[model samples]
Target: MKVLITGAAGFIGHALIKQLSATAEHVVGIDNINDYYDVELKHARLRDLEGIGNFTFIRADLVDAEVLNQIFATHRFDCVINLAAQAGVRYSLDNPKAYVQSNVVGFLNILEACRNFAVPKLLYASSSSVYGLSKDVPFSTRQSVDCPISLYAATKKANELMAHTYSHLYGIQTIGLRFFTVYGPWGRPDMAMFKFTKAILEGKPIDVYNHGQLSRDFTYIDDIISGVMRLLEKDGLEANSVFNIGHGSPVSLMDFIRAVESATGMTANCNYLPMQPGDVEQTWADTQGLFDAVGYTPSVKVAEGAARFVEWYRAYYKI
Candidate 1:
């Protein structure tokens, strides 16, 4: 199968492409390689995929409609996976335009291309942040995600709505995976997992948001890839569907820090801080819907996942 995966250099996108290419699928990946965190890290991800025979990488921004359209025209991909977006809740507070341009305008271009090209299946990444401000434990796809606290969450919620419209109007099978706190090797540096690990290793105090009161589902990257692969391989899914791809077990901020410390064999100096803007106290996902459809659920626990990430971090940095 010929597949097109956007955000090729991203945490999830990089891992997904590696797995798909290993299966001998002709996978084309595209990324703008924006200086959101570290451009060299993004380059490193692309470099790692260099020797794969079935993989191809293109450097392009999603908002460039002409380039994206040309790609669709040339490839006529059997499946399109749209993983590109302006991520981070706190970053969205100061730079709301980035979220609108990348998540809103860029996504519109992707939907248009899929509609015009008549692509049969399109799977896109959504986020657990969409469940903002709802006291709802184990946020399910059935619940109303009408109230979003951050511009980031608002854009993701908008993606689901836009996808539903296209699926109804154009008969495209659109699947939205609401990923929860995805982390592991090649994880984004802006995320808690990477940040905490970096600080702890360097003997710096790790900032604990919400005064150390936050909790997250903390789904591992490998399990996320497995879930996505299951959906891609399965047939006859609903034309418009969204699933909460998560570990289904929420890990507390303190517990997560402890796991990091255990993995690194160093105590973390915690710096307690009030909640930042566009941040939530907790995120828990009801993954039953995903399991029902894909026959898979995220299985990695935080302790094991943290150890694996630290191992990679040490080796990659030669720390």
Candidate 2:
């Protein structure tokens, strides 16, 4: 089957594409390769995908509806997995415009193309930040995500609303996956896991935001890929569904740091500080709905995941 995987050079996107390649499916990948992190890292991901047959890479912004529709016209994609977006909650503070352009306008174009082309399942990335300082533990899809702390989160929440509109109007099946703190090899540099690992390995101090009190549902890349693959192939899912795709177990910031330290066998000098703006204190995913629907259960522990990431990071960075 031919599939259009947007953000195909990204962290989770790269992992998903590798899985797709194994099946010998025709996959058309798109990415703007913005300098949100290192462009080199994005290219490296594309290079890896290039080695596989039946994969096409297109570097373009999603806001270009003409280009987006053009791709839709050229390829009859069985499904379109939209993963591209302006990421990072804190970075949204400085570049709110980026969030609007990529997350809102770009998403509108995607919904429009899906409406016109009638792609089957549209799986887009959503964020836990939509909960917005909510004290509720294990955030569920049933609860309203009306408040968003960052512009990034607001755009993601907006995407869910937009998808619902199209799903209702055009009879398109769209699934929004509210991903937690996803991290592993080839992960974004802005994420805490990548930053901490890099800093600790270089004998530098890593920032402990909120005095190391923050907790996150740290999911491994492999577990996430498994969930996505199953979700993609599994038919007869409810239309206009939103699922929390994450490792249910949340890890404290300190505990996470300790795991990273263990992974690299290096003690980190932490620069403990107050939390930054647009930062959430904790995030836990209530994935029972997803589990019931698709038998989704994350099996990777944080320690093992961290160690695996360190191994990949060391080999990739030659450090």
Candidate 3:
């Protein structure tokens, strides 16, 4: 199958593209190369896929309809794995327009391309943040996610809705994967793991949000890639069906911080602060739908994953 994966420069995107290119029949990637994070990190990820034979890369923004249209016409991708979007919940509060531009308008272009080109399935990134302020312990796909705390979460929910509309009206197959806190080597600098690692290495203090009382379903990058590949193998079922791609384990912020500190052989000076307005106190995924559909299971334990990530972080950053 000819597959087109968006956000090829991102952490998850790089892993997904590499895994699929190595294992699957054919794969093509696209990214706008935005400077939301360090563009160098993005390019570095692309460099990793440099010599792989089955992988192809295209540099363009998803919001550019002309480029999207031309590429869709050129590739005629059988399946589209969209991981592109302007990320960061806190950043969304400062610039809500970026969220709408990338998550909503960008997604619309892709959906239209899928309909026009007759693409079969679209596996896109949704977020656990959409379950904002809900009292639910373990987030289920069937749970209500109407109260989004930030523009970022709101746009992610909008993407799911947009995909569903295309699916219902155009008979397109759409699957939205509600990703938990995804992390590992090749992760974005904006993520907690990456930031904490960098700060600890430089002997800087790290901000402890929710006063270290928060919990997150921290998923390893390998686990996330595995779930995505499995979902791609299966056909899309309904218009608005969302699946949680996670380990079904929620780790406390302090516990997670300790793991990071242990992996790097350094102690962190944390400054406790109130939970930000746009942030959720906890996030845990109910992976029943993913397992039922794709037999999804995560193998990496949080501690072990952190160690591996630290090792990679040290090597990659030359620390």
Highest lDDT among the candidates is held by which one?
1
C-alpha TM-scores of all predictions: 0.99, 0.98, 0.98
TM-score winner:
1
When sorted by lDDT, best at the front, the candidate numbers are 1, 2, 3
Q: lDDT by residue for model 2 over 1-319, one digit each (tens)? A: 8899999889999999998877746999999999989999999988877777788998888999999999999997889999999999888999989999999999999989988887877999998889889888888888889988889989999999999999998888999989989999899899988999999999889989899889999988888888888888889997899989889989999999999999999999999999899898999999898899889889989899999999999999998
Between candidates 1 and 2, which one is better according to lDDT?
1
| Total backbone clashes of candidate 2, pairs 3 or more residues apart or in separate chains | 0
Expressed as tens digits, the lDDT of each residue in 256-318 for candidate 3 is 999999999999999999888798888999998889988999998889989998999999989
Worst 10 residues of 3 by lDDT: 232-241
lDDT of 1 by residue, 223-299 (tens): 99999999998898999999999999899999999999999999999999998988888889898988899798677
The CA lDDT at 153 in model 3 is: 93
- lDDT (CA) for every model shown? 0.94, 0.90, 0.90
Model 1's lDDT to the true fold? 0.94
